[model samples]
Structures are given as structure tokens and as C-alpha cells.
Target chain A: EPEVTQTPSHQVTQMGQEVILHCVPISNHLYFYWYRQILGQKVEFLVSFYNNEISEKSEIFDDQFSVERPDGSNFTLKIRSTKLEDSAMYFCASSEGTGRGGRPGELFFGEGSRLTVL
Target chain B: AQKVTQAQTEISVVEKEDVTLDCVYETRDTTYYLFWYKQPPSGELVFLIRRNSFDEQNEISGRYSWNFQKSTSSFNFTITASQVVDSAVYFCALSDFNRDDKIIFGKGTRLHILP
Candidate 1:
């Protein structure tokens, strides 16, 4: 089965540095999203992208956070400046389309990128 | 606002035994969706099933079954005669049709299958 693929399975970055997490969504997927989870914490939605624009974002998605679909196949999330609290597992998900979760391409998630900020 | 609660932080069961994980969700929207996903040690998510709030019909797929009761705001998953491979973290997520890609997930219930 086709699945969402993310690069840099694990990343170690210094505080105040910049990092970009990349994802290649399924070929036919239209909706893409970025979520993060701290160890032992619930998964939290950070941002959603569709039609080459941000559809929605959470409070955690501050000015320091930005998501872009630079090209047809690559979707990326850039952290302008990393903080200790920014360390978490970042997940990229894509859906062929959304039909209240019943439709065919219902949110397939990638393995996730473990970001460590020090 | 949406919140899903998997009250049972962890569960333990022996091989070939049955187990059920509870999921309670709170949402204000009338039209929403519920889903169950599994994450193994590899930290990869595996989609299990999806149930819409309007459709209360319970479903059973192979050894997995789901009970979606809107009255109680619960969507429980049951694994029958589970094997060691069934051990993993189970998460329940909630989303609404009105929204495009906003899904909220719970902390998840960790299942441990023993020999």
C-alpha cells in the first residue's frame, strides 16, 4: 500500500537553530497535515495544508512555525527557531480525500520524525 | 473543541485471550467521525476502523470489533483471541466533516500481550 514518507527519521538540532521536516505524501492525496507528540502525550495537530495553502492551524503553530508545499510532491514544515519544548515526534499524514473519514484515502500517517532539540 | 479520552492507560492480557479498550470522546458538532489506530514499537500508525456519528451500526472485521454508542459517547474496540502481535498502543481520534483535516487523538492505551 502507498503511504506517506518523511525524511530524516531522527534529527538532533541545537536550540535557536532552524530545521525543516520534509514529507512526500501519497501521489493522489489532496489533503496533508502535520502533527506532533511529546513522549507519552496525545498527538496534537499543528497545521493542515491543501490547495497550496494553509487550511487551519493550532495555537502551537506560532510565527516560528511554517508549512509549505514547495513543489508537487514535497510538503515541508520549517521551524524558524527551535526550542527545548519543540522536541517531539513529528508526523505527516495525507488523505486521498476526506469524506468524514469513510472515503478511500482516509488519513495515512508516516512513521514520524523524532526531533531532539538541545 | 474536541477531546478523546482513553481512560485505560494500559492493559495486560495473555496469549489467545480477549481484550477491550475503551474510548470516550467529547465533541460539540453533530456530524463527526471516530477512528481507531494502532502504533507498534516501530512508532508507525496503522489505521483500524472508522465510524461516523450518524451511523451507529456496530461493525466486526475478522477478529476486531467496534462498538460505537453515541448515547454514551463511547467507541470501544475489542480484539478476540488476540495473539502476541496484537500488543501495541491503541489510539482513538475524532474529526468532523465540516473541517478538512483537523483530527484530535487521545493519549492512547498501551496493550501488552504476554506468553
Candidate 2:
């Protein structure tokens, strides 16, 4: 089965440095999202992207965070300045827009990218 | 606002024992969806099941079954004759159709199936 794929399975960066997390969603998927989970915490939604634009974002997705679909296949999340609290497992997910298929609401997630900030 | 709550922090069960993971949610939207996902030690998320608000009927798939009760706003999952392979962190999630379809996950329930 086709699945979402993310690059840099694990990353270590210095505080105040820039970091970029990349994801390649399923080819046919129309909606994409970025979610993060602090160690021992629940998964939190960051932002959602559709039609190459941000559809919605959470408070955690502040000015420091940005997402881009630079190409047809690559979707990326960039943190201009990383903080200790930025360390977490970031997940990439995608779905065929609602009602496109009988099960349109289902989201397929990728094996997350673990980010460690020091 | 939408929220999913998994009250059981951790559970241990002997092989072949039946186990159930509870999920309670709060949502004002009339149209929404609930889902169950599993995250093994490898830290990879595996989608298990999805139930829409309109469909309150219970469903069974092999040794796994789901109970959706709209009246109580709960969707619980049960595993019958569970094995060691069933050990994982299970997460219950909620998504509102009227919103941007952002899924909110609850603190997971870690299940350890002892052999």
C-alpha cells in the first residue's frame, strides 16, 4: 500500500538554529498535515495544507513555523529558530479529500521524524 | 473545541486475556469522526479503525471489536484473546467535519500483553 514518507528519521539541532522537516505525501492525496508529539504527551496538530496553502493552524504553529509545498511531491515544515520545547516526534499525514472515496475521512500517517534540540 | 480522552494510562494483560481500551470525546459538531490508532515501540502509527458519528452500530473484525455509543459520546475498543503482538500505545482521536479536518489525539493508553 502507498504510504506517506518523511525524510531525516531523526535530527539533532542546536537551539536557535534553523531546522527543516520534509515529507512526501501519497501521490494522489489532496490534503496534507503536520502534527507533533512531545515526549510522553498526546499528539498535537500543527497545521494543515491544501491547494498549496495553509488551511488551518494551531497556537503552537506560531511565526517561527512555516510549511511549504515547493514541488508537486514535496511538503516541508521549517522552524526558523528552534527551541528546547521544539524537540518532539513530528508526523506527516495525508488524505483524499472528504467524500472523494467511500472512506474519505481516513488519514494515513508516516513513521514520524524525531527532532532533538539541544 | 474537540477533545479525546483515554483515561487508562497503562494496562498489562496475560496472553489470551481479553482487554478493552476506553475512549471518551467532547465535541459540539453534529458531524464528526472517531478513530483508533496503534503505535508500537518502533514509534510508527498504525491506523486501526474509524467510526463516524451517524453510525452508532457496533462493529466486529476478527478478534477486534468497537463499540460506538453516541448517547454517551464514547467509542471503546476491545481485543479478545489478545497476544503479545497486541502490545502497543493505543490512541483515540477525534475530527470535526465542519472544521479543517484537523485530528486531535488523546493521551494514549499503553498496553503490554505479557506472554
Fraction of native Cα contacts kept in each candidate?
0.65, 0.54
DockQ of 1: 0.66
Residue A60 lDDT (model 1): 97
- In candidate 1, position A75 carries an lDDT of 93
Give the alpha-carbon lDDT of every model.
0.91, 0.91
Which portions of model 2 show Cα errors greater than 4 Å? A99-102
TM-score of chain A of each: 0.94, 0.95
Highest DockQ among the candidates is held by which one?
1
Query: lDDT score of model 2?
Result: 0.91
Model 1 misses residue B52 by how many Å? 0.6
